[model samples]
Target: MQACRSAGLARGLGAVTLPWLWGSCRRSLSLVCAGSAPRAGDWRPSAGLGSRARRLSLSAATIVNSAPRPLQPYLRLMRLDKPIGTWLLYLPCTWSISLAAEPGCFPDWYMLSLFGTGAVLMRGAGCTINDMWDRDYDKKVARTANRPIAAGDISTLQSFVFLGGQLTLALGVLLCLNYYSIALGASSLLLVITYPLMKRITYWPQLVLGLTFNWGALLGWSAIKGSCDPSVCLPLYFSGIMWTLIYDTIYAHQDKRDDALIGLKSTALRFSENTKQWLSGFSLAMLGALGLVGVTCEQTLPYYTALAAVGAHLTRQIHTLDIHRPEDCWDKFASNRTLGLILFLGIVLGNLWKEKKTEETKKTIGSRLEN
Candidate 1:
């Protein structure tokens, strides 16, 4: 009878506590989704990942959390939990490499592999650098305050040490490329090293990020041709910058309201009420630059078809944009991954079509010679 009474008491307590616990969880989720900072002791979640979660139903953090406690902070620091930035950085490289394919051939698979691996290391390094520069600022931002460095899960010295390690690994990747490409890749570091400071000095920091993020457009072509000529990749590079301006602007809005409170700079805060118009202007510029890429590379109809798709996607993103809603901005920003994939596919298919025409011409010449 005593044992039964103890079980009954535990059941009664659980019934009383469960609803309150659920309520807290709901409140917490709301605050997180709304970009509101949680109290110091509360669990902090990642922002801009609701769409990612709904799609993958899992995240790097969830998987890394299952690992040993010692590794969780580092993995988050590298943004292994958020792979979108890596994808964004890498796709431009693929687009450049693929666009520069030998007439009727795929881009160098070996070079693509090198660039892909390099992108992972370099993007992580970039994030580490950004975190290091922004740790103090991060502490003041709702979405970023719990970042590994800002939360005191990792130290500044450790982050710099870690940054050094990433740069060393990236150097090894750079050594695999030809001298011109190596030099080009190395020069990009100037932009990377300086990008973090742009937010403090200019509302157009997204422009600086564009310059940094899109270096792969030049690097990709130079790796294949052993030279980066202005005539060949300038258009591609410009297109990438315009594209970055569009997506990064959307990304900036997520932080704009907070940035105003903190006096940080961004295109979102700069464009304010006229974002859709500015995005439209950027879109036209990107499309025009992409058309130049087709002309310079002599890409075929399939390439334009894919470009058309890219255009439609960008249009839809702009049309649906609700600048006041951070969640809406995040969804639009995340959609750029799909845009990158589409553009890559377009480049690949255009080359395949060129290859087919080349084969057809060769076959016809052989028949004539036989006759």
Candidate 2:
């Protein structure tokens, strides 16, 4: 009879609370259904979960929450629950590494592995740094209010300590590269450390983010070739920055209304009703620079084909984008990962095609000489 009463109470609560809060109420409900009502002091508010319940749908959030309690806040601080930023940062590295591969070969697996590790660490460090800087402003914004630092789950001193550890690990990764690459990679820290402040001063924070995020375009080439080939790497790097502008601008749109309320600046607010036009301009710039990369690198038909596909993909994103709807903006922003992969596939296949054509020519020459 007690269990039946508890189950009835649980159902009533579920009917009233939001979907996300239902999980929090589960523990209390479970105890009740087990025939023992939680004592008055035993009941905990949903906020006791500290924003974890709000993000239950995210797979990474699920993984983070499964860890030891002490580690969960730090993990959240690093934005591990959001892996898309890491992918965006790493994709540019893969592009340069693939392009720098010896003709007819895939990118160096060891270098790719090394850079992949660096991307995760550095991207996490970047997030930690950003959160630390933005925690105050974040608290004022609904979308960001639940962030670990903003929600008071982690202290500034604790976040600073965490940032140090992340940077130290990232430095260890950088030391594994050649001296020039090491120096080049280390220089990017300035951008990483300062980028979070850009929103407070300029509408072009996405531009600063582009400059920071695409440093990998230059670093990847130097790692593989011992130094960057300006003709090739420069164009690739430029293309990456332009691509960043397009996606990050779309990402910025999600917070623009809040940003306006709080006096923060972003391209989303700068372009306003003209955002699609600005995105189109950035897309054209990105495509043009990519074409230059293909020319400088002497990429084959497959590469250009991939380039064409990227243009179409960008076109679709801009055409269908609804800047007023944050969900649509995020979907468009996430789709750029696919865009990056398409170009990477092109670079790999293009090299193989070039190698095949070279071998065919050699065979023909050998046959003529024998005749």
Candidate 3:
């Protein structure tokens, strides 16, 4: 009777244990499924898994926040972030117009409008070409590593397409000019094509850039006067070269580290420690050259006064510059736009004033002869 009672108890206990064990196994499998599944809000942390997950989420958020914004990529490629290039390219053209108009009349609205459009199209084209050529090298430089071409945001073929579009717009603008202006415009292609390669072979790519950028000075003179006279255009062009050197040196400071790592050469890297002194010399030279041009052209008193404003602007740029800070360098470089505008207005007002004086002189002389 006792043995039979003991066997019944053992059987009952086994029966109860089996279902409990199976239920726990099922619960474990469910937890594993929940953890591995891709559905939203289905995370099942095992033991200490919750903290690790929080860390991962925070890291992902940080990366997304820190990544370069999408719009910046486009702006970087176009160099819209750096407006100095535009000013450098545009100012020389403005000088040419002012100088060309010196002997005749002030720059008309039509000429100014043409120059404005040309500056936009040509600067875009130049940047695109520069990016396409520097794509491989850009990938190696930290500052340029994430640029459109280097980061694979735009392919070589896409760059070529963009180049085509820019050229088309520029060509359309060129067609609006006279035959001589058109010819002078076409002649710039050689310089444009050769400019990107200059950094690879020479430290004086700034000089090459001066030649390329200052072509506008020549074009402006030719567009207005329909002929090339060195006496009128040379001073403006030479002044442009010096201006390019000064501003471009500032620009180069932004890339000094990346350039050094990539084995690229620039005046900034070449004159790293003494950049300020060199810049001072260049600025003084530019001012002197411009002064000579103003005197030679006999620009009106207002024009000279405007040039004095430019001198003040240059003084401010030099005084506040911290070449070690790229942002400061860029700001100083961009301030040149104001300089360009002041000079442009000066040239226009000067010519207009001269014309008014000439008319008054003629009237007085005629009255005297009549008397």
Candidate 4:
């Protein structure tokens, strides 16, 4: 009699409990489903998907974002909204300019200004080309799926035309320089053209990016000197490449899962578990190259000091890197801007040191003559 009552009580409890549990699950499922309901003519990616969705704004607050709706597409196509890539592209040029200068002298500020303009134009053009080449592939990567071309916000032909305009402006910047620099600058196009394809074929696309992006190091030296000696410019170029390797690897980590899903490859995948080790190697290579660059350029102790500062910054990044977290990787990648500025300032200080030494030498010579 007791057993029968206990069973009856348990059945009554389940009868009451099942409906509530079912209702709760329905509500939870509906909440998850609400964000992805189909809409007519909607091509925008779901807000809940992907690392970029979590980390970056759905739309960047750029000049393009602020523009009239009709004109917004073109500016975004140029990526005027995000300036980090522009800085990364331009810094190598300044590095070369600073290093190529005679001891104790200012870098070519005029040329720096010109390279800045050129970097803006050329980076836009490169983005255009990358989009055009990867539009189909881009639509598959959640982070890039809404890229103007990939989202049908900009057509391929229109992108090509915009690319032409950017190239024309870049050419104008090139004309402001000498023929040697023009020739050197023109060679970079080959790298830009091939870069989008690199990810398809090799896990080392970032390596190609290192070579392509750092061409400015070579161009900067040639712009001033009309030619580059292997010894003088090579170290800067190599260091820039190593720097790219470090940062781009971090960037690749942000999209590693997506890349894997879609048959793409990156260093992020290749060094998945051992990322810090790889970053350590790249960082060492970059710093070692900078040290060699200092030796080759006859930079003083301050140059190495500045290089040490860069190393410390990279060390912190590597130490703090949470490779699995998209936000952290993006932050580390963005931190390269600070790294670039530090190195630039270091070069300036090293030159000041050289200038002081020159002044001391002149004073010693004058005193001896007077005696």
For residues 1-371, could you state the per-residue lDDT of candidate 1 as single tens digits? 23433553454354342211111100110010111111112344455754442222234445556678998898789876665676678778888888877666655666665676687788889999999999999999998998999999999999999999999999998997899999989999989989999999999999999999999999998998899868769998999899899999999999998899988999999999999999999999999999998988889888999899999999999999999998888778877877887888889788768867877899999999999
Which segments of model 1 are wrong by more than 4 Å? 1-58, 363-371
How does each model score on lDDT?
Answer: 0.79, 0.79, 0.69, 0.76
Q: How much is 341 displaced in model 2, in angstroms?
A: 0.9
Badly placed stretches (over 4 Å) of model 4 are: 1-60, 368-371
TM-score of each model, in listed order: 0.83, 0.84, 0.75, 0.82
Output candidate 4 Cα RMSD.
21.9
Q: After the best TM-score superposition of candidate 1, give how far the Cα of residue 294 lies from its true spot, in angstroms.
A: 0.5
Instruction: Using TM-score as the measure, name the better of candidate 1 and candidate 4.
Output: 1
The TM-score that candidate 3 achieves is 0.75
Q: Rank the candidates by lDDT, best first.
A: 2, 1, 4, 3
lDDT of 2 by residue, 129-232 (tens): 99988988999999899998999999999999889998998899899899999999999999999999999999999999999999999999999789989898
Highest TM-score among the candidates is held by which one?
2
Worst 10 residues of 3 by lDDT: 24-33
TM-score for candidate 4, residues paired by index: 0.82
Whichever of 1 and 2 has more TM-score, that candidate is 2
Clashing pairs in 4: none
Clash tally, candidates in order = 0, 0, 0, 0
Query: In candidate 3, which residue pairs clash?
Result: none
Candidate 3 C-alpha lDDT tens digits along 1-371: 23433553454354342211110000010010011011212234454754553322222123223457864555556554343465567667766766775433545335545665566567768988998999999888777787788999888897788778878988987897789999988999999988989888888888889889889888988887887777667877887788778878887888888887888888888888888788788778877877888787887887889888988887778778888998788667666656776777787677767867777889999999999
